[model samples]
Target chain A: EAGVAQSPRYKIIEKRQSVAFWCNPISGHATLYWYQQILGQGPKLLIQFQNNGVVDDSQLPKDRFSAERLKGVDSTLKIQPAKLEDSAVYLCASSLGGVRGTSNYGYTFGSGTRLTVV
Target chain B: AQSVSQHNHHVILSEAASLELGCNYSYGGTVNLFWYVQYPGQHLQLLLKYFSGDPLVKGIKGFEAEFIKSKFSFNLRKPSVQWSDTAEYFCAVKAYNTDKLIFGTGTRLQVFP
Candidate 1:
């Protein structure tokens, strides 16, 4: 089975410019997530999608960041007028929805889009 | 609020050496713990997880973690590590009732042959 797929593995943009990352999750997965990983840091949750509806987006910066999971199969995360602090790897992950007996079943992540804002 | 912390930022070791990485979280309520590994040029993958039952959980590639609820710690360990085991490890936690995860700054392991 194919794993989560992300496009534009690397991106370079200037401050104040716009950038977007795309993701295609594993087949049949109902939960999708977007995360930001600054250099030397772990991935931080930015948003989550359950089917076509958003499950959580408490960490998302509403002023500059936006994401959409149009059909529940693919997602796009956008940062308008990016800032230097936005330089990080944008990771996408997916998991089978519903509850795992204990925790939710493990998540499968994409290789990530490395964004460099100059 | 839930937060996770990794004690070590970076570690260097020779191949075949033992490995232990410490992780702790602050949460008054119950929690679920996880350990994830990211090899160079790779995505994060689950190494192991702990929810209930045994405090000790074994995962793939000989990796294991012991979850201590009293101390709010879930430390990953490997008795013998190969150069292939060199990677960045992250510790994460979620509240007992939620699926949202809070992650710590990762620990980078460098294994020299």
Candidate 2:
């Protein structure tokens, strides 16, 4: 199976500038996720999509962070007016999203985009 | 609200050494657990998961995790580790009936030959 794919493996931008990261999940995956991993810290879930609709975004900083999955497939995460704290690895993941009995909570993650906010 | 905890920030071991990494979760509802590992310059991959019927779940590369409901813990273990085992391991949890995941700060294991 093709793993989740992310683009622009690295990015650099000045503070207050905006940037967007793209992701293409494995075929047939129904759930997609965006996560932020800071240096020396664990990955934090920012947003999740079930098909083309959002399933969760409670952890997303709506004021600056936004994400969208179009046509139930590819997705993008954007950070407007980026802050220094926004410099981190952005990971995209996809899952079968079936019942716990079926999928067994498995997830496939992309290599991630490393963003540096200067 | 739910969160995951990993006790070790980093671990170093020689070849053939035993390994154990602790992970705990705080959630009032039923939960699902997972352990993911990322080798250097690689994407995160699922090592194992625990849903039901088994307290001890075996995963790829001889890794295993025991889920103890009473302790709210799922600790990963391996009998003998190789230098190839060096990587960052993350423990994640999902509340039953939910689609989101909560991850713990990773534990970086560096195995030496």
Candidate 3:
């Protein structure tokens, strides 16, 4: 099976600039997730989408970070007015199901997009 | 709120040595636990997962994890590790009723041949 796919393996932007990352989940997966992994830290959930509707975004910094999974297959995460602290690896993951039976299928994560804010 | 803890930030071992990485989660409910490993220049991949039955679960590459519900822990273990086992391991947890999968700060393991 094809793994989750992410674009622009690396990106560099100045502070206050805007950047976006794209992701294509595995075929037929219904749940998509976006996570930010800072240096020396675990990957933190930024947002989650069940199909095209959002299931959770409680941890997302709405002011700067936003993500959308349109048509329930591909997702895009955008960071506007990027801050120096926003430099990190943005990871995209997808599971075969939603909240209920997701654990059974587990998640497949992409290689991730490394962003560097200068 | 739920969280995961990996007490070992880094570990160094020689080939043929035993390996153990601690993982603990704080969620007082039915939960799912997982271990993911990322080799150098590679994407994160599942090492193992525990949903139910058999507290001891074995994964690929001779890796296994014991899920101790009483201790709120699922620690990865390997009887003998190879230099190829060097990588960062992450522990994650998801509550039964939630869609969020929280991860703990990864533990970097470096095995020397």
Candidate 4:
């Protein structure tokens, strides 16, 4: 089975610039998520989508960051006016179902996009 | 709020040595625990998970974790580790009632021959 796929494995941008990361999740999975992992830190949830609608995005910084899964199969996360603190790895993951823990399934993550804002 | 903690940041061990990595969480409600491993130049993969029923769960690559509800801890362990086992391991948790996951900072393990 194919796993989640992400692109532009690595990216570099200047502060005040804008950057976007793309992700294609596993087929048939209904739950997609975006996470940010700073160096030496765990992955932090940025947003989640169930089908084509958002399930949770409480941690997402609306002022600078936004994400969307238009057709429910692929997703894109964008950051505008990037800051040095925006340097991190953006990971995309998908699960077979969206219900909390009813199904015994673990998320399959992509290779991730490493962004370095200078 | 839910949070996870991994006590070890980095660890070094020779091949065939035993391994134990400690993890604790702060949520008082029921939780679903998970252990993920990321090899060098690889994506994070599930090592094992504990949903309910059993406190002991075994995962791929000879890895296992024990969940002690009393201590609010779930520690990953392996009787013997190979050099290939060197990787970064993370502990994560999600409240049984929600889909959001809270992850730990992770532990880097280096096994030498």
Give RMSD to native, each candidate. 1.5, 1.5, 1.0, 1.0
In model 1, the Cα lDDT at residue B8 comes to 98
Q: Over 4 Å off in model 3, which ranges? A: A99-103
| Deviation of model 3 at B31, angstroms | 0.8
**Interface RMSD to the true structure, each candidate:** 2.4, 2.2, 1.6, 1.3
Name the runs in model 4 displaced over 4 angstroms: none
TM values, all candidates: 0.95, 0.96, 0.98, 0.97
What is model 4's C-alpha RMSD? 1.0
CAPRI band for model 2: medium
Kindly list the per-residue Cα lDDT of model 3 for residues A1-118, writing each as its tens digit.
9999999899999999999999999999988999999988989999989999998898899998888888999999999989999999999999877556554767999999999999
Candidate 2 error regions (>4 Å): A98-103
Candidate 3 has what TM-score? 0.98
DockQ of each: 0.61, 0.63, 0.74, 0.76
Which DockQ-derived CAPRI band holds candidate 4? Answer: medium
Deviation in Å, model 3, residue A104 alpha carbon: 1.6
Each candidate: fraction of true contacts kept?
0.64, 0.70, 0.77, 0.75
Lowest-sum lDDT 10-residue window in model 4 chain A: A96-105
